[model samples]
Target: MKKLVISLALCATNSLFAQQNWLGNTSPTYEELIAHLQQLDRSHKEVKLYNMGPSDYGQPIYLCVVNGHRDSSETFEKARQSTTILINNAIHPGEPDGINACLIWLDQWIRAGKPLKSHDGGDLPVIAFIPAYNVGGMYNRSSTSRANQNGPEEYGFRGSTKNLDLNRDFTKMDAVNTYTFVKIFQALDPDIFIDNHVSNGADYPYTLTYISSMKERLAPSMQALTYAHCIPTIKDYCQIGNFELFPYVELKGETPEEGIVAFNDLPRYAMGYASLFHSLSFTVETHMLKPFPERVKATLQFMNATIAYAIGNAERIEIARKEAIQWSQAQTYFRFNYQMNEQVKDSIRFKGYKAVYPIHPITGLAQLEYDRKQPYEKYIPYYHFYISQDSIAVPKYYIVGGQETKVIASLKANGVEFQTLDSFETKTVTCQFVKSYKAPTRPYEGHFKLSEIEIASSEQAILLKPGDILIPAQQERAYFIHAVLQAKAEDSYFTWNFFDSYLQQKEYFSAYVFKAQIEDLLSKNPELKKSYEEKKALDIKFAQSEWDQLFYIYQRSPYFEQTFMRLPVYELND
Candidate 1:
């Protein structure tokens, strides 16, 4: 009887985990979630789970991989021609909803064994899951015994302790331990990717924000199906802000870096890494400060809808994504996407480029000419570089961590003066409350209001004391860091960088035009040129280099068969 009881208990335990406990109302702790994933891995050999490496706070992050093709799922093909889909959640533990939602998604695709009927019985695509991208921040113990962080942030535990916003690191890639995992991910070229995050505060902003760095016309069509099937809760709450929230929208011609494609928007870093290397990607955001259940529901809706959208339109999206590759090849002004504003009173101003020069990836150099013709006043004359996409020159402003002083000093040597002041020490407070009477007037519950309070940095108490505002617990962003930067053409390296980038960036802007524009030629206008034969040879060399790297990877995998399918479609013929 004792033997039989123990055996039955073991079976029961296994069976219990197999059930769909992920999306359920009862939340699971980090350990519980990890254990459940392990248990599921046993049943689904297709799902591979790994730790991207532990966090500074001593928590092991769980990264799950789901190979898309049935035939190539297990063994490595000669050409590891696979598209990786990386999704992560819970950078801030209090925003555990995204993590749970991701778990629910894992359960649906892995255990529920959803049929591929939608794919015409084709193999599903592979996925590289970083469900809790911010494991350390999310799992670190809060002042309260709560499983995840909750807000009225000042009321939440360790409210300001999570100073390292992982989102900002996308372009910077400065995190060492993180680079180890990132290097592995880099090896596998991902086709599509998304990073999940929760938004804080009163309005509980509902809309999904895609990195607006993508070309305008294609952005909507690419995300078409995703918006279709979202659960009403998320769909109803959805607000479509591509690159940024306020500045990018309100200021005409301002080519602000709000999307993932910029220096390193974390989502942009991940997605842009995929896109630049030739793949499709996404960055996901869900409002966090709203009621807990609401956030989870919306996140899950977004996830499921996204998966379903990918599955349903896999063939179509694949073609559209491929078209993007073609579009990228023949374009000029390749860096920023420009939107012309007609609301100006008189003389049409030069708004910023919709895109900017592509980063060299290694040297971290983004020297560009100061385009006097740039549309946005704020964006003019200054070139941009992100350590990862969202993070600006961290070393120059404040000591977020590590040694960034040199990075700041370099910019200053170039004449960019910025400062990082702690809220407690510096008394210059600029917390403004703007009133809105828009029809959708969200009863404005205030967020971003930072107050002063005295509290020990112990893990026992809620991170902040009463009356403390939610300003930077040392988190900083001040755009107007320095005074006006006006300079003449001859003395400025910005002029050279800008002209060089301007020529190399566009498909037609050639080396011939590059110099002639400053000298012989008159037209600085982007439209007048149709094609350039002078730089045709150079462009081919650059394009061939990109193609060769891609083909080299495909040559080594079971996907070598695809080479025949893809190779014959040589773009060189044109």
Candidate 2:
């Protein structure tokens, strides 16, 4: 046992050493990444640097779009034509492995002065690399930088005013300069997105390479495809982690025991926004905890593989990418030029996660969790989620609560004005396309089309046919229920009485809670249990209850219904 720990430590150190050597192993400040990008641009005509937006720290977050062809607005919406690979590094500033890989990839691709043609047999894939995600954090100090970039890393993190863990802050849009990089994304949509970050450390050799949970149309295997078509170049050279289970090869939201089933962490999310609304996105995590050199090697391996992934899956890849950008450009909820965010949740660590964040006057934060355990050698495949471009819309941005003060700051920063409407002023609200969903009472796949929907609430919050509804205003302590029950992946888009930004958690937490409660209640009541035993008959009521609840909230709030549901409106008997 002791020997194992020592071995892990040694591996980590060696990896770090290699990582440092790769990109010159120097810790770059926001300025350095920019300078490196500029140098790449100056040397290569194929690479063009476009500024996305300023980050929180008032630094210019650059969007490096590399290709021989210029992207016009008309071609921007056409996903069939352009196949883009979006790469982001340093979202967690302390993790520098990805940035080095990014820098190296740029140098190798554009070929500076002699750049004659594209990489692929003449038609190279277009790549968008945002080397630094959290310029604010990147500018800060690193206990492990080995070399400093942003003024010695000492002034980078005070944790006050900037109390944000950037990853967590995604749900709350910020008007700060850091958002600049993201702005272009909304404008020019890319095909495949890879948001990069370093893992905590190398304690786990498996703490590397992540594939985001994406729409079914995207991959035969997110991680596997990365391995098969994209990431193989660096697999041996760089330590990689694949999303697998202990024994099962199938992808599922729950285990035999029933718990929160989480997918990839940062890359999962960064790309999720794209996937959920329309784009195919993936997050890549290189284990920084490994020796820096190892991390760099792994990151470079990922970069190479990612380019190949886009190339290998060129046709479908274009469909997914164009769909994302065009969808974003014309997306109902995402179109407002306003930023949208969702809370990430976990079940074991943070059980019973809910989107209970209220609107206006009472702001509570929507929490998120990333980096759950990677199943051992026995790996289970993931059941992909549905991402539709149905287009939900919101007219005016409403602050769900005071807790959303940061949201307000961000909203205001983005130039969005929010007015707290009295019952009369509640006339305007956000509208979005919520794909329709219907799940069986017995365990089954939920089915529904992506439809346009709006949300606001006075009596009840806006509702969707919730897949795994977690009810009861209170709990006996989150995630404590043993033998928790759960709904399948198809049972997503559940009921909620409140709103925040959005939190794309496992959806397992709420499912487990609701499944557990329902299963328990049916077991306890003979009549009710017997009635529910005929799940097909009872499912109508279960689903209706959900729609009805949401209907009440929508009717109460200024937001109106955008789609149809079997909601209970009145009782003839009453």
Candidate 3:
């Protein structure tokens, strides 16, 4: 180990010294970045670059591992067993601070003799990074994409080749990049996960801001480890590096003076997806107003601090993750639909510039801007509490219909364990029916994303056909399963349009033809007859319209389609 470290140090100093290309107001192109990493992989055995999978742009997404075992399989195995930190860069390719920061970290580590131990003599964690996640965006580079960003000569666009925001593709898995990302993420199974980006909000004095996984969404062990241990430790380390760490500036109202709220890290985002499986997830946001070099430096400092934290607390992290997995398996209910509790507020000492609205000379409109000359430091209301509006009783197993191939593929990609039924069978299970939902008028991330979802559940005897998948809730990925399968969860597959076909009424009855059947349907069922009479008596519109009366009775009749609004996923409680 000593010899290898010394050799790496010599290689770093002599042949592969730290390059200045990433140190200024410039970022590397996709080809240049890959070629550099490939060179490093060839030069040092500790550095390993793997072509995980292809992106939407037809280019392969790469995972670069530092301090790995010599062989590919063994390196991944070591990462899974030991403490690991996985940094994902350039998800939004325009925010390339992480890419430069990671490069600088590699250079500095190699030059520092590649120490294998922390300051307290604990083993250093495995460090892995996805050099550039959005390959298409990285290739389509320009300077004008980020109009408000400071001093990057050129950068990639925010959208992928498919014109989808890759950040929002995590739960939906619409882009090939998401699949590759899942492959990389599951392979590493890192204890700490970071997605790097630049901020797009109010001007804050702090250059570095981080968004941790929402506390309500995390398992108890993970929640404590993240908020009580990891964050505080990283903040101290950042302070030591001559920088301050703050929460992401997600404004409560319009500006910082009104206060900031904790970011709701829904499963659609990269960090939130990682948190589902108990990774200590964070999104690093460098102030976009800061110079490119300054942002890069701050990002690098954060990386160092996080790595230092992982090194010092490797055992604790591993234990917390293990406990989290167990906690997930033991969960009786899965809570979601988290809304920020505006009424509950804590105070944080914030340093920010005064918000000023001035008339724009070009447009003759009042523009909101931060006054650099009027910086202030004071306590501000920080609304960090989030309350889960709903929760579902977790089932023993979830049986997904055979036709839901896309959802099955997504679950498989995330390493969810399940058994495929070989033959048909019948079992009583709890199924969710879509009561109501609102879809966006316009497309979001290539989907008419669903919202305001209300669901109703009932016990039903469902026939399990051949090729149907039964996923046990007593597995390591239970949290992930619940996050996607629960129809009303904010980022569930249903919300992402995975089960849109089921939402549509596949079959409809002609009002004239069904009118004859409605009389017999109500006559045979006394309860239905009473309800129909009550509806006609109470509602003037129902009494007046023949089609409405006939259709309403027809929908409740036995001839109506059973699977019209029923979800393909069924839960087995017993």
Candidate 2 global lDDT: 0.43
Candidate 3 regions off by >4 Å? 1-18, 71-75
Q: Which of the two, 1 or 2, has more TM-score?
A: 2
lDDT of 1 by residue, 282-357 (tens): 5554544345455566666655555554554456656655555454433321122122322322221223333445
User: Each model's TM-score?
Assistant: 0.46, 0.49, 0.96
* Model 2 spans with C-alpha error above 4 angstroms: 1-24, 68-81, 110-122, 144-161, 175-178, 214-260, 264-268, 320-574
Q: Each candidate: what lDDT?
A: 0.39, 0.43, 0.90
Q: State which candidate has the highest TM-score.
A: 3
Alpha-carbon shift of residue 350 in model 2 (angstroms): 25
* Candidate with better lDDT, 1 vs 3: 3
Better of 2 and 3 by lDDT: 3
Show how many residue pairs clash in every candidate, following the order shown.
57, 76, 0
True-vs-predicted CA distance for residue 365, candidate 2, Å: 36
lDDT of 3 by residue, 163-263 (tens): 99999889999999999999889888889999999999788788889999999889999999999999999999888988999999998899988988999
